[model samples]
Target: MTVAVGAPFRTVRELWPIAWPVILSGLVALFINGNDAFLLVGSSDKVLASAVAASAVQFVAAMVVTGLVGSSQVLISRAIGSGRRDRAARRADAGLWLGMWGGTGAGVLLVFAGPVLLWLLSGPAIDGDFARAYLTVTVAALPFVGLGSALRARLAGLAQARGLLFASIAAAAVDVAVAVVLNHMIGPFGVAIGTVAGSIANALVLAWFAVRRLPAPTGVRAPRATAVFGVSRGDLRDLLALGWPEAILYGASSGAAVVVAWLLSDGPAADLAASRILELTTSSIAWIVLTGIGTAATTLLGRSLGGGDLPAFRRILRHTLIVTLSVAAGIVVLGLLLYIPILGLFAPSSVREASVPVVWLAFAQVPLMALHVPVTAAVRAMKDTRTPMIASLIAEYAVFLPLGWVLTRVIVLGLTGVFIAHVVFWVVSVLIVGIRLIGRIRTPHTLV
Candidate 1:
């Protein structure tokens, strides 16, 4: 899973290989999630309402380990760039150990604490009982999601992202098939169980390939790769240092959706439904697609920096930014054009009225998102996740939520105000993150 980072990919051909698989995989993963909506279309608004909460809940909880294990990608890429495959192996080992244990703990906490957590996160957006049932059944998926993230990080670092795509396809297929079968037998909870099944399938497939293709290090002189938890304290610390901010960043993003639901709870039910549907669909597309681009940026920049190739990093960043912005623009246009039709297909008949008007705000976010996703990725690649995390906190708490509260609650502008605030949050975030990214790019390797 280690490849030397020599020259930057100079041609469009080289760039396509890194970007396409990750993008396709993101799309495939979306299909797995898309099942919750597509299959449950006939369900009531209460069940439909659970969609946002369930999605946010899984992401928020899973993000804890996902962010930590994600450090494996950073560390592994750097090691490969510097021609230290053994170090990459250690990083991968650390990721797996932490992902397993951390994922388990998160799952246990969420399952046991389901009622309270769902109460806060779901707000009045979803039926409390339905949310709990969904959350409880999907508890087992958390660990698999964590491990799958770790495995994905390694393949991404090694630039073998096609493996990740294969996993995603398998996961999506399993999810759809199981969901269909179980829905007939068991009713609404089928989708939740199917989600869990997909997670396991994804992790298992990734593990199978990893074991056979990415062999264990031999004739190596690091401590046995198996300590009590399979990695050394140093590697653990390294992961935490890089990962905590990623956790915070992702958690904040996920938690923001829940917060939005809470804000919309007191308003007209249609508004909340519209917002949630937009979040699960339109907004999800922007974030997911940008995430694929961000992955490419991370791998290229992480490896380039590790190899002490500043020029390569610069070029890679530029290429990433151009492609991300271009793709995001296309996504925004297509999403806007197809919003009503897509919503009609994906959501029940109840949501169309409130959704059509506010969906523009969701689409408006793509430009800002296109800006920050790669800029922040570049910052993270430089091993300074704190800056982006701090920026997100400032934007989310200081600006986004507070401004949203005022616009919606104090001013009574409803969903209009909420989406406006959402757009503004990214504007503020892009400025903050861009400044840090530029600084790090100029300095190279210096955390400051």
Candidate 2:
């Protein structure tokens, strides 16, 4: 069954059509999530301040869950590809249980240790107090985020992208509406509570759908917090075996971002502000391209691996590279054309003076950023998690951080240098990871 490149329904083409909606849905969600900050900036100064603090806490919580429970995407995606529906169900159960325990642990730590965490990071006593209040409310909402991410990954693994997209859109709409009304009525604290409430609503909707869509067994009671979700011991072991490396990969990447943030925080006000602006822009685009391609890659490559078709798996990898390049070029061109307008949306006056170059430099790497996602994702699909983790770790620490340090500290380019460093980092990342992925695809493995 050799599929032609121009075939109408080939796996590669099929993923493209599905991926566009998923990517667009994710971008809309990001925009909606940022709505509170956007809308409240003009309301009251206090409301604006609170929105900033709360958004930080919410993002930190999201990063924690995203780095940890995101492994479910790879685990469940591979399980479905293997045609092990029973095992897939069990993996979902284990993931749910894991998310619960992980969320509980993090929530407890935030309750007890959050103040100290904020104090250490805030750079001043007054700032620490504000950060603490925000962290308090946001931490209280962690379980919902954790649970929702796990369920969403399960749904994605099932290839029910439309359902996931719809639920996400609904959730985003409710979040923005509720946050806006509350921000005007009850002030910034109201906005924070409204945001949490919205996430709770999203979780409830997804939980209902997940329960309905998931397979049921005759006599099994849902497992306890430790063992609940109907996951067996064997399934738990397998998921961890596959998921831990992916978790570390995400954690390392996020941790690097935080370090870079801290480094920039010590610079001049313009430098700090410029770095933050660059981050927001890069993050917005990165989530769309990386996350969409990663999900699509896991599904397609996992299926090929499960069907024992190495050639098919190889073809998917090559197609992913081609798709990445195409998307990357489009993003770069868009960035170049809209640099002034897009940067103006965030910091109109200062953008041209300080942030535009950084933003555009980050944009220039969109293709390289695209290369990173699908390649790493294909490795996960092949159950070769160690390779990606190792490669990403090397790229982040040995390549990204070191060069960024020199560019920002030693070089005279300031913010521009930081942006240049970002591009260089991604270029190096693509080369290293891309080569490794190519090697894996070329060397076939037998699954006896």
Candidate 3:
């Protein structure tokens, strides 16, 4: 994929070049993640629950790790769009620095605070030996999670999709191989070990590309390994300015999800496992597909705004919406078609019956799930991170949490109630950001 040189995307096909790699990369990682269910075939309900729960927590925490990647996306894309290659490289270095520090800090917290957080979020139901064992081993992946994500954001800004895809493939290979070997000997903890090994492999390769293999946009001298930690104060401020809102929003969202889990945990654990299965399975697929479109939107939007072309930015938004809606329909249809197989793969017999409808119910979220990614990307692309953050806060605290509490607690619907609340959350959250997005995308071709 070529970085935009102040020119707007001229056709829909242009997006495929930027979109496919990240989508493929996410799928590779997720496949290994989903394989956990396959690997533990004869496991008990609690073992199955612990496997999914610990993994879910790890995944959410990882998203929080990379959530601020928008900083690099906005900064380097703008610099590249403006033909300021040296500036783009410097901004990327700052992002790398931030990622390392943030990820390291997060890891420490997961180790020290994770148990407490677990107790608070899930109570007695989930505070068992297997879950704790999985988390303790998997926590080592924290730094790699951050470091790899930062390197990826930098590559994305430079439009180096192939590099990103290759790194993901490498990580997936190591993760799967390690998990397969270890699982035969150690069971559930093998998945945890695989995550750490794969993360380290992923980080190493991405670092190789960032420092040596990938060519920086010419104005900077080739970046050195040590340059990542040499970020200036100004660069830090710039990253934080565009990054914090989305970061905080993700953090809040993860917390909100855990509370929903707590509600489900209060009931039968099969119900909880069913909920987690739907989330890690269908929800993950939806996010990966939609996020491909969002990443494309971010790239196109950042370039158009950086080059001061308002009409082009709006055009990109229009194209993004068209693509998202079309893809959303396919996701729903595919989810319907695969419903039986998915339940077979991830749900134990205990969870299987409950999950039958939960799988169908999840499709209620596909449309809005698809829509929100690009809409939020559009808003964030204009560097208006705070508005989306505010919009999300309202969507969650004001609507999602209340609705979920009613459906699961007051109404006593259990797993089904949680899914219903999820559907409504996406609906409300999408609307708030979408209304704001409509106004911004209509302005003349320029940065908001």
Best by lDDT: 1
Q: Give the C-alpha lDDT of model 1.
A: 0.78
Model 3, residue 58: what's the lDDT?
67
The residue-by-residue lDDT of candidate 1 on 1-448, one tens digit each, is: 1222333335234566766888888889877866786677667666666765666677678776787678778888888888898788788777888888888988999877766877875555577778787878888899898888888887787777777888999999999999999999998888889999999999988877676654543222222325326678898889888888888887787678677877877776667667766776877777888888788778878888888888777777777787778888898888888778867865656678777778788899988899988898788788878888888889999998989999999999888899999999899999999987777667655732
Instruction: Score candidate 2 by lDDT.
Output: 0.64
TM-score of 1: 0.91
Instruction: List the pairs of residues colliding in candidate 3.
Output: 309-445, 310-444, 310-445, 310-446, 311-445
- Mark the regions of model 3 whose C-alpha exceeds 4 Å error after superposition: 1-10, 123-127, 216-222, 442-446
Lowest summed lDDT across 10 adjacent residues in model 1 is found at: 216-225
TM-score-superior candidate, 1 or 3: 3
**Backbone clashes (count) for model 3:** 5
Ranking by TM-score: 3, 1, 2
Instruction: Please give, for residues 254-343, the per-residue lDDT of candidate 3 as tens digits.
Output: 655566666766777677667766776787788887887788678878887888878777778777787888888988998889777757
TM-score of 3: 0.92
lDDT string, candidate 2, 366-443, tens digits? 777777888887777867777767776777788777787787777756677666766776777777777887776566
